[model samples]
Target: MRWLDADEERAWRALRRMMIAIQSRTAHDLAAAGLSEPDYEVLSTLSERPGHASTLGEQAAKMGWSRSRLSRHATRMEARGLVRREPDPDDGRGCYLVLTEHGLRTLEDAAPAHLESVRRHVIDRLSSADLSALERIARKLEEPT
Candidate 1:
């Protein structure tokens, strides 16, 4: 396999830096609002769907997290009244994570600042053509082999 040459390596490093900075800034901003990025994602995702509930496995997969990580986070949030755990009716051994009313309200409060951070760090940094290019590259990278 051909390794990346100097220019490609430099570009890869730049992309990595941008990715890290974007995530860091967003997480920091969310932290100020009393939420983590993962918390925002979980809350928003559940609120986006009907029933406001998803199985533990489903939540883990959606967040690209392990089941244990999801469970641990959910436990913390549950204690804070952000969510609740319930038995999954269809699967005897499975469980669901349901977003509580408090979680929904918290997510709504955080959305504006979260969106502004994203726009300022990423969206506003790119031109329309660059945005399209980024979309294409990102989609390609996400494709299954």
Candidate 2:
């Protein structure tokens, strides 16, 4: 097996720790707005789509989630009146995940605080050069092998 060298190990560990710390802190911040990370993800994703809707498959793919997982989460969100499933006009076998007015309002209310939390946790901590390097690294990592 190819083992990471000392420098690579340090970099990987730092990235992992940073990700976990940021996610934990942001999750806590989102909770103050009555949102979990998944909830925020769903709301934000739907909000970006035309008519605030997208097919479950599409959304799942975009989020890099399984269809079943997204479907289950959608059910929980629906129970809270945050989102609803509507029959897809073009696809009889599928449904679109549509954000409710409540969902939009909730997202609108939560976004400012979320942005603030993000800034406080990461954005404000990084220099322009750091952000550029991070962005380049992230894009490179995201490229399909």
Query: Best TM-score goes to which candidate?
Result: 2
* Top lDDT hit: 2
TM-score of 1: 0.91
Regions more than 4 Å wrong, model 1: 1-3
TM-score of each: 0.91, 0.96
Which residue pairs show collisions in model 2?
A: none
- 1-120 per-residue lDDT for model 1 (tens digits): 999999999999998998898899999988988999888988988886679999999988887889999999999999999999999999999899999989989998999999998898
For all predictions, the C-alpha RMSD in Å is: 1.6, 1.0
